[model samples]
Target: MNDYAIEVRGLTKRYGQRTAVEELSFVVPRGSIVGLLGPNGAGKSTTLRAIVGLLRPSSGDSLIDGVPFSALDNPASHVGVHMDGFGFEAGISARRHLEICRLAAGAPRSRVDEVLEEVGLAADARRRVKTFSTGMAQRLGLATALVGSPRTLVLDEPANGLDPDGIRWLRRFLRAFAERGGTVLLSSHQLAELEQVVDEVVVIKQRALFAGRLGDLVTSDADSLEGKYFDLVGGASA
Candidate 1:
């Protein structure tokens, strides 16, 4: 198998005259957790969207295991995605929603219950989505992603709605996934959480800025990831 689970090659995205991402390139190593770090409007979302084929790039390409997301035969089986504000019908039960996704992915029906338990949503499985808290909704999104048992996960701001305990749980779960040979590319506003979980970090300021092992970014002189992040992106914003 390839050492890289995902590779972006000179990826660029534009909106009319405005460029969102420019010549971005990076790689998520196989069986590792990589953090995509950037400030607001730094094209993090745009970059991720392009990888999942939600938007076409104006130039360059993104590849998963050497193939574009659109070209994959059974994409859900290989790449599971959880973008910000993933939606569901307000009235649908969480269980029903997962069942629908399982059918669409042609995954086994047993996957629904398995994912529910895995995400700690089995107890609330029958509850309407509208009644779920932000944390619950996030779990549901994760469950949806896991239903296909994909080898790679591309999640955007997955820690947004999670509380302290939930964040801890997620850290443990993702680490365990990587230990099991799953690749993870996670985008997050929480630098502290990223530092705790990611094996590598990719920083961007509307373009590729830094890509390296987590420890490399944090020099002996640097105090923390927040300080490093500011040093990396602070100049760009100013």
Candidate 2:
């Protein structure tokens, strides 16, 4: 099998005269948890959208498992994506929502219950999505991504709504997923949580800045992911 789960080659996105990203390139190796870090307006979302085939890159390619996402068959089984919006219907039950996703992905009905349990949402499976807390909603999004049993996950702001305990749970869940040989490419503003869980970090601001193992990049007792990131980006807040 190919070693890289995702490969972005010279990715560029533009909005009329404004350039969102220019000549960005990165890779997410198989069986690793990689973090995509950047400040607001750094084109992180744009890059991710391109990777999942939601947008066509202006001047490059975004590949999944060695092929462009648009070229894959049964893509849901290979690359699961949870972008900014959860895309849940407010009135529908969580269980029903997942059932729909499963059906669309050609996944078995059994996955609905299996993924709900995996994401700790089985107890609230029948509740309406409008009634779910922000944290619960985040878990539901993750469940939606996992319902198809994909090998790679591309999540955006996955930790946004979680509380302290929920953050801990997410950390453990991501670690377990990597341990099981799944590749993860996630973008988040939560640097501390990211540092605890990611094996590799890709820091960017409108272009490729730093892309490598977190350990290799921060190789001193006094150094930290946050410090290194600030040094690279000049104290800009995410």
Candidate 3:
């Protein structure tokens, strides 16, 4: 199998006269965590959506582990995605949701319990999703993503609405996940939190600006990723 977990070449997405992502190309190697950094509406979400087959690009294509996302026989097994919302069945218990995903992915039942424990949701496994706090819901979303042991993870703002402790847990979890040879692609406006976790970063302004290691992007002595982001995007700080 190819070493790259994901590959995008000449990616472009346009809606009428407005272009969301333009001529973007990047490769995420196996076992690495890559952060997608940009302001709101900077095409970070759009790029991720296109990569995960949620949206079709006007040009170019994305490959997940050497197979085109569109052509995969079981796309969820290869690439797991978590967007902004949990999208859980509010009436179902968290454990039940995971069990459904496990059956669909053909994963062992043991994996359901394993992922719940991994995301710190084991205690709430039997709780109805409608009763979950935002952070708990986010954990459930993460659990769903991990249920199949997917080779690559595409998450847009996985940290959204998380408390401090929850954020810390997520950072540690993602770091460990990457360390275990899993690939991660995460998009977030929370650069402070991202800098603590991501190994590399892909910064997109109104366009594709930079793609490299995180340490390389923060060389300007900025105290935070948000500051560096503004500098790169040519926007003045408030």
Local accuracy by lDDT, each model: 0.92, 0.91, 0.85
Who is ahead in TM-score, 2 or 3? 2
- How many clashes in each structure? 0, 0, 0
Against the true structure, what is every candidate's RMSD? 1.2, 1.7, 2.3
lDDT of 3 by residue, 122-215 (tens): 8999999999998898899999998888878999889988999999999998988889889999988787788888878888853678888877
Regions of model 3 farther than 4 Å from truth: 220-223, 235-238
List the candidates' TM-scores in order. 0.97, 0.97, 0.93
Which is better, 2 or 3, measured by lDDT?
A: 2
For candidate 2, give the lDDT of residue 140: 94
For model 1, how does the per-residue alpha-carbon lDDT over 62-158 read when each residue is reduced to its tens digit?
A: 9997899999889999999898867999999999999999998889989999999999999999999999999899999999989899999999988
Whole-structure CA lDDT of model 3: 0.85
Error of 1 at 7 (Å): 0.3
